[model samples]
Target: MGDYVLLAISCILVNNILLAQYLGCCPFLGTSKKMETAIGMGMAVIFVLVMAGAITWLLEAYLLKPFGLEYLRTIAFIIVIASLVQFVEMFLRKSIPALYKGLGIFLPLITTNCAVMGVCLININEEYTFVQSLVTSFSYATGFGLALVLFAGVRERVLLARVPKPLQDTSIGLVVAGMLALAFFAFKGMA
Candidate 1:
């Protein structure tokens, strides 16, 4: 239990997929413009990531390894992630139409987000047990949510502030994101 808790914390604040390794920057910068959209994307991503992690781990353990077809891990993982993304999309479109519309392309983009595949690969590579894989993936998604929401809040302020025309939008966003990444790294030692 303690190990799982520590792994979760590490994946979240310290080894964050966005702020730490710089994965999923597309959604981080794109969907993060609005707090509501960012939160929705975060939640959707969390669900997909956790599901993909578990499914991939099971596939790797039960089929790939047993059949000596480990080379197909990437393909298998992609299928699982894509399936989860489709499910999330349909569910959100049905239940939360507004947020679903707000998310737009960003939600589908989660299907290709390397972070989801990366965490699953990491779980298989590290040979994390079922519970550990789930916890780690959940934490990574939580970290993503944390960064997205916080960045959205800050970006709301950035939008209001007057700035030179050259750095009006994404240019300033990139700078702020870099700084946020650095700020997150400051906690590396604690984990």
Candidate 2:
């Protein structure tokens, strides 16, 4: 239990897939312009990441490993992640049209989000137990949500602030992201 808890914390903070690993920045920067969209995107990613982790772990352990098809891990993980993203998109579209629309094209873009695929690959490569992988995946998603939400708050404030013409829009966003990444790096020492 303690190990699992520690692993979760490590993934969420010290080894954040987005902040530390810098795997998925597309939606992070794209949807973060607004709090609602960032929240929606983050939730969608969390749901898909957890599902992909579980499904891909089973696939690697049972189907791929048994058949000595380990070489196809990348392709297999992407397929699993992509399928999960599609399912999420359809579910969101029907259950919550506003969120689906608010997310805009970012919903579909998650299919190619390397962060999900990276979590799947890491779970398999690390040889984590089923439960551990699930926990790690959830933690990673939580970290992503935490970052996006926090950054959204910052962006909302930045919108009203006076800024130099040269450092507007994404330029300022990048600067903030760099600072945020550095702040996340502070967690490394805590581990």
Candidate 3:
């Protein structure tokens, strides 16, 4: 339990996927212009990441390893992630139209998010047990959510602040992200 808690905290604040490793910058910068959209994207990503990790772990342990098909891990994992995202989108559209409407596009976008696939690959490479993989997946998702929401909040403020002509949009956003990354670096000793 203590180890799990520590791993969760470390992943969320110290080794964040977005801030620390710079993974998923596309969604971090592109979808975070609005708080609502950021939150929706974060939640959807969390769901997809955990599901992808679990499914990929099982496939690697059962199908890939047994058949000596480790060479196809990347392709297999990607197919599983894409198919899972599609299935989730369809399920939500039919059962929860409100959520589907809110996250419909983001659901599909998650297929290529990189962060989801990255977590699965990390778990496989690290040889984490099933429970450890689950915990790490949740932690990675939490970090992704934190980064998304934090950037959304910063972007909201950036909209109001007066800025130079050249750095009004993406340039300023990059600077702000750099600062946030520095701040997250302060948590290096947390684990």
Candidate 4:
């Protein structure tokens, strides 16, 4: 239990996929302009990452490994992740119309989101047990969520702040992201 807790914390803070590993920068930059959108995107990503991790782990252990299909890991994992995303999107549209609307375009965009795929790959490469893989996936998603929300807040403030003409939009966002990444580095020794 202690180790699980530590793994979650370390993954969330120390080895954050977005800030530390630099995965999924596209959505992190593109959808962070509005807090609402950022939250929606983050939640969508969390759902997909966790689900993708579980599915990929199962495939790797049961199907891929058994048939000596390790070489096809990337392609298989991607297919599963893409299919899972589609299923989730459809389910959300039917069962949670409000959330589906809230997520809007980001829902489909998650299929190509590198962070989700990255988590799946990490789980396979790390050879985490089933429970550990789930924990790590959730932790990674939490960290991604934290970063997205934080970036959204900062971007919101930036909208109101007086700034030079050149560094107003993406330039400022990039600088802010860099600083956030640096701040996250402080958690490296926590575990």
Candidate 5:
């Protein structure tokens, strides 16, 4: 139990997929313009990441490894992620039309979100057990959500602040992102 707690902390604060590892920057920057959209994207990512991690681990353990078909891991993982994205898209579109519309193109883009792929691959590469993979997946998604929401909050504030013409919009966004990443670096020693 204690090990799981540390693992969660490591994934969330230390090895964050966004601030620390720098995956999923596309949506991180795109969907983060609005707090509501950011929250929606984060929740969607959490669901997809956890499900993908579990499914991929089971596939690798039961299907790929047993059949000596490990070479197909990438292709298999892509298919699984794609399917999960489709399910999320459909569910969101039907249940939460506003968020679904707000997410727009970024919703489908989750299929290619490397953060999801990266964590899945990390779980396999690290040879984590099933429970560990699940923990890592949830923690990483939580980290991504935390970073995205925080960045969104900061970006919202930056929008209202006075700024030089040259440092407006994306220019300042990049600077803020750098600062946020640096702030997250403070947790590196905790692991």
Candidate 6:
């Protein structure tokens, strides 16, 4: 139990997929303009990352390793991740049209989000047990959500602040992201 707690903390704060590792910046920047959209994207990522991690782990453990098919790992992981994204897309479109519309291109972009692929690969490469992989997956996704929400809050506030013309839009966003990354660095020793 204590080990699990430490792993969770390490993943969520010390080694955050977004803030620390810089894995999925595309959706991090694109969907972070509004708090609502950011929250929506965060939740969506959490769901997708967790499931992908579990399924990929199983695929690698039960199938790939047994048959010595390790070379196909990348292609297999891509197919699994893409299929899961498609499922989420269809479910959202049918069940929550508004959010589906809100997410727009960013939702599909989750398929390509490095954070998802990175976590899955990390789980396998680290040779974590099934439960450890699941925990790491959830923690990483939670960290991603936390960072996205925090950044969204900051970005929303920045909208009202007067800024130099040269440092507007993405320029200011990148600057703010750097500052946020520095803040997350404070958690490094906790792990």
lDDT (Cα atoms) of all candidates against the true structure: 0.90, 0.91, 0.89, 0.89, 0.95, 0.96
In model 3, which runs have C-alpha deviations exceeding 4 angstroms?
Answer: 95-105
lDDT of 5 at 186: 93
Q: Per-residue lDDT tens digits of candidate 4, residues 1-191? A: 99999899889999999999999998899889988878878888888888888889999999999999999998998899889889989888899898788777778878788999988888878889999999999999989999999999999998999989999888999999999998998887675
Tell me model 6's lDDT, rounded to 2 decimals: 0.96
Show where candidate 6 strays beyond 4 Å. none
Displacement of the residue 104 alpha carbon in candidate 1, Å: 0.8
Clashing pairs in 4: none
lDDT of 6 by residue, 1-191 (tens): 99999999999999989988989999999999999899999999999999999999999999999999999999999999999999999999999999999999999999999999999999999999999999999999999999999999999999999989999989999999999999999998665
Model 3 residue pairs with clashes? none
lDDT sort, best first = 6, 5, 2, 1, 4, 3
lDDT of 3 by residue, 51-128 (tens): 888999999999999999999998999999999889878877888787677664667888899899999999999999
Clashes of 5: 0
TM per prediction: 0.96, 0.97, 0.93, 0.94, 0.97, 0.98
> Which residue pairs clash in candidate 2?
none
Where's the lowest-lDDT run of ten residues in candidate 2?
76-85
Relative to the true structure, candidate 1 reaches a TM of: 0.96
**Against the hidden true structure, what lDDT does model 5 obtain?**
0.95
The TM-score between candidate 3 and the true structure equals 0.93
Q: Encode model 5's per-residue lDDT on 1-191: one tens digit a residue.
A: 99999999999999989988889998998998999999999999999999999999999999999999999999999999999999999999899999999999999999999999999999999999999999999999999999999999999998899999999888888899999999999998765
Best by lDDT: 6
Query: Candidate 1, residues 1-191: lDDT per residue as tens digits?
Result: 88888898899998999988878888888998999999998898898998888888889989999899988888888988888898999998999899889999988899888788888888988889999999999999999999999999999999889989999789999999988988998989795
Q: Record all residue pairs in model 5 with backbone atoms less than 3 Å apart, i.e. clashing.
A: none
Q: Which predicted model would earn the best TM-score?
A: 6
Better of 3 and 5 by lDDT: 5
Which pairs clash in the backbone of model 1?
none
